[model samples]
Target: MHGKRVLLIVSGGIAAYKSLELIRLLTQAGCGVRCVLTEGGAQFVTPLSLQALSGEPVHTTLWSLTDESEMGHIALSRSADLVVVCPASADILARMAQGLASDIATTLLLATDTPVLVAPAMNVRMWQHAATRANMATLRDRGIHVVGPDDGIMACNEFGPGRLAEPPVILATIASLLAREPVPQDLAGRHALVTAGPTHEPIDPVRYIANRSSGRQGYAIAAALSARGAGVTLVSGPVSLPAPPGVALVPVETASDMLAACEAALPADIAVLAAAVGDWRVTHPGTAKLKKRPGQPAAPLSLTVNPDILASLSAPGPRRPALVIGFAAETEDLLANAADKRRRKGCDWIVANDVSLPGDGSPGVMGGDRNQVHLVTADGTEAWPSLDKREVADRLAARIAAHLAPHSLIRNSP
Candidate 1:
C-alpha cells in the first residue's frame, strides 16, 4: 500500500469508533492516511485519536478557515487513491444518494472523481427500512462500492444487519484495490456492445408483456466490464438502473429496436446478449387504448416472431461482434437447453440460469442474495456456488476479458 493514500471519512454511529483501528490498519499496511471526521462522528471518537493513528491532521469542516487557505477539502480528496467511509449511517447514505454537500465528507465525495466505498452502520430497524434499501440501490447504480453492515447484534441489543465491517476487512479491501492489476483489454480501443433487460411487448397502450428479470445480474456485469476500462455501448431495454459512469447508453423498447440499435452501434470486440427478450410481438398492437368488451369480444391478437438478436450478432456481417455471449433463462433441464442455445444461436458462451424458483430458499439462481450458476463452454460446464451477483459478474467478466484479451495481454497477465 506504499505510495497509496487512503482518505478515511468517519461518519457518526457506533461504528465510527472502529475508524481509529481502521486508520491504524491502513497505516500499518504502508498507506498514507488522511482522516476526515463528520461532525456527528466526532461525537463518538475524537480527532486526536484518529490523528494519532493516521499521523496526519484530521479534516472536519467544509468551511474550515484554516484549511480553506489551501483549498484543503478538494486537494485532500482528489489526491487520495480511494475514499472510504466507515460507520456510514443511514443519514449519511441518504445524503450521499441525494448528492448533498453541506458537510466536508459529502463535499469531498462530490468533488473528487475517485472511487468511493462505504461501510454502513445503523440500528437494525433503520437498516431494514425501505427508504434505506432504496437509497442503497441508487448508490450502487452510481458505481459506489459498499462493504459490510454485516448481520449481527447491534448497540441497541437488536439482532440483524447494519454492523460495521471490522478493521481487518477494510484493510484487506484496501489492499485488494491497491494491488488490483489493470485489465489490458484487447477490446481496449474497440467498442463492446451489450444488451440487457426484458424488452416490453405491448399488449395494449396501457399494458405490455414483460418479464420478472430485475436486470441486476446483467447490469452488474456491465459495470464490471466498464471498470476494466473498455469503450462500452450498452443497448439496454427498459430497466430501473443507472448507466454506469463511463459507458454510453441507448434505450430500446422492443426486440427489433434493440437489434436495430445494436446494428447501428456496431463493429465491436465482443457482445453480451443478456436480455430476456420476448420471443414474439403482437401482429397489430393497439395504438389507442383498447376498451374492455361488453358484448363484442376482445380482438384476437395474432403474434409474430421477433428478430433473433443473438443469431444476428453471430452472423458473418460487417458489424458482427467478434465474440457473442447469450443468456439462457430456463426452468428445468438447464444445461441441456443452454447447450442447445449455444448451438442454435452460434454464440460463444451461454450464461444459463434457472428462474423457476424464487424464494425457494435455494439461494442465488433460485432466489437469494447470492446465485448458483453454470457456465456452458463448447467443451463442458463449470458450476459456481451461490455468491452475491457482483462477485459472479466479476468472475465472468474476468473470464470473458481473458478470452478476448490479445496475445500480448495473455503474456502480461501473469
Candidate 2:
C-alpha cells in the first residue's frame, strides 16, 4: 500500500482519540493520511495532534480560505484513494445518510465518488436505534464499507455493540482494500466530457416538461471515466445526485443550457451524451403559473425543437472529440432505431436501451439501478447483458480506454 492515500474523517465520540492511532498505523504502513476533524471530534483530539501524527495539516471547517484556494473540497475529496470515517458517530452517520453537507466531513463524503469505509461508534442504544439502523443500511446499500462497532463496554458503560473497531483491524481492512486490483489508468492524460440527467423545459415557473432520468447511469459513467485517470467534465441537468469525485461538474437545467455547457467543455478526447434532453421546449413559457379553471379549456402550450446536442458535438471540427457516443432510449425496435440514431446524430457510437416497461412489472431502466443495453457502431451491434449501471459504466469506460489507447501513442509521439 505504499503511496496510497487515505482521507481519514474523525467524528465525535470517545473513540475519536483512537483515530490518532489509526492515522499513525496508516502512515507507518506507507500510506499518506489526511485528517478532517469534525467540530465534535475536536473536543477529544486537537488539530495539532492530528497534524503531527499524519504529517499533514488538518481540515476542520469548510471556510478555510487557504485550503479552498490550494485544494478545494471537491479536489480534497477525490485526492485520496479511499476515504475512511473512523469513530463515525451517530450524528455524522445520520447526516451522511441524509446527504447533509453542513460540515467539512459530511460535505467531503457527499462530494466524493471514491470508495468509502466507515467505522461506526456510539452508545449501544444509539447504534440500535431505528434511525441509525436505517442510516447504516442506506450507507451500505450505497456501497460504503463498514468495519465494526464490536460489542464491548462503551464510554457510557451500557453497551451491546457500539465500539469502534481496533486501530489494527481498521488498518488491516484498509490494507485489504488497497490490495485490490488497481484501476487501469489508460486514459491517464485524456479529457472526457459527459452530460447527464433530464433537461427540464419549463412551461411556467413551477411546471416543466422532463424525462424520468435519475442521472444514475451518466453519473456512473463519469465516475468510471474518472477512475481511469481521465479528467472529466460532467455537464449535468438538475438531479438529486452527488457529484462524482475527480470530475468537474457543470450544472444546468434546460436543454439549451446543457448544450452550452457541453460546448464549453469541448476538445475532450471522449464525449458521452447520456442526458435525456427534451426534444422540444416551450416556445414561450408563461410569465406566471397557468391557472386551472373548472369547466374551462386548457391553455395552449406551444413547443419548439431544442438544440440537437449530440449532432452539434459530433460535427466535424477541430474541437470535436475523437469518440462521440450518444444514447438512444427506445420503446421498440431498439437496435434498428439505435443504429439509425447513430447515423443521424453523426456520432461514432450509440448505446441503445429499451425504456419500455417490462411486462413483469419490474422497474424500467430510466430511473432504475440496472440496465440492458446494445452498443451500435459502424462495424456492428454488440448486446450487453442486464447489469448494474456501475458495471455497465466500467465496461463502457474500459472499451473507451481500448478505443483511445492506440491514438494516445500517436498524440504523445515526439
Q: State every prediction's TM-score relative to the real structure.
A: 0.87, 0.62
Q: State each model's CA lDDT, in order.
A: 0.81, 0.88
Q: How much RMSD separates candidate 2 from the native structure?
A: 8.9
> Which 10 consecutive positions of candidate 1 have the poorest summed lDDT?
405-414
lDDT of 1: 0.81
The TM-score that candidate 1 achieves is 0.87
Q: lDDT per residue, candidate 1, 1-414, as tens digits? A: 988998999989878888888887788778999989999998999999988888899998888788888998889879888999887999999999999988999998989888888888999889878788778867876767888878888888999878888889978887887777766553455567778888999988887877766566677777777777667788888888888777788999999899999888777777888888899998888889888778998778899999999998988766566678888888889899999999998888888877665652244443233467789989889887765677777888888778776533211110
CA displacement after TM-score superposition, residue 174 of candidate 1 (Å):
1.8
How much lDDT does candidate 2 score? 0.88
Instruction: Give residue 172's lDDT in candidate 2 (0 to 100).
Output: 95
Alpha carbon lDDT of residue 365, candidate 1? 45
User: How do the residues 179-273 of candidate 2 rate in per-residue lDDT, one tens digit apiece?
Assistant: 88989989877888999999999999999999888787898899899899888999999997778767799999999999999988877889999
Identify the leading candidate in terms of lDDT. 2
